[model samples]
Target: MGLRNYLSDVASGVKSLLTGMKVTGRLFLRHHKEKITQQYPDNKDTMVYPERFRGEVVMPHDDNNEHACTGCTACELACPNGTIKIITKFDVTPEGKRKKAIDTFIYHLQLCTMCNLCIEACPTDAIKMAQTFEHSVFDRSQLIKKLNQEGSKIREGVE
Candidate 1:
């Protein structure tokens, strides 16, 4: 009886192995139609990302080089990783009234986890996540980017 049981166990193992091999053989034969390998760099131009894909943060500046950031620091506060820094400047109106404005908006790409919390916290809709994912750089200083365009000022209605 023991001998019969051992023989049955061996037969069962062999049957399972053969079944797995049969599936693998079928896949090997159908590899041409169902390509398992991607061409990588060659397919870069054709690669498409979803609408909701989060890559990096970018501030959209208008043709006038103006943006909606009011130096409110809402983005700085909401960032979980302290990736955003806002340098403020005082804008003096014609009436000699001083108002707070954004001097520079610094974004540390190396520290950012792309959580989108900063974009959500912004009341002025200033910042948004860009679809550009290729952010690799040789130097760490290159990763720290200014989201605002050069010589860009806050929009007129942003106050």
Candidate 2:
């Protein structure tokens, strides 16, 4: 009885495999006019990605090199892995009070899962997902990016 049951299971598995292959063969033989495949390299210049595509996280700096990130570490805490590192420094205000500021915003793209959790946790809308998807690089170090621009300061009115 055990041998018979094993044979029956193997037959059912083969049947399922054949059914999946049938569908794939039918699609493979479909007319060329169908939009089943995308010519990626050919249409590289004209490719249009959807607006909701979460490619990478980025901090948009304004014309005056000001960002909205307050070194709150909200994004770093929200990441499932240690993909984001926010190095902070204390800046003395005019009144001699210390305020937290971001010295560097390190983003490890190789470790990122593109979960969008960090973007959602940002209270000041300091970071958001960018649309640039081509992230291939020769060296692994190239995947590590510093989000904040040089000499960038916190934007006025954004804490």
TM-score of each: 0.90, 0.78
Give the per-residue lDDT digits (tens) of candidate 1, residues 20-72: 99999999999889986789889988988777788999999999999999999
Top-lDDT structure, candidate number: 2
Where does candidate 1 clash, by residue pair? Answer: none
Q: Candidate 2 residues 8-32, lDDT tens each?
A: 9999999999999999888878856
Compared with the true structure, model 2 gives a TM-score of 0.78
Off by over 4 Å in 1: 1-3, 94-96
Candidate 1 yields a Cα-based lDDT of 0.93
The positional error of residue 15 in candidate 1, measured at the CA in angstroms, is 1.6
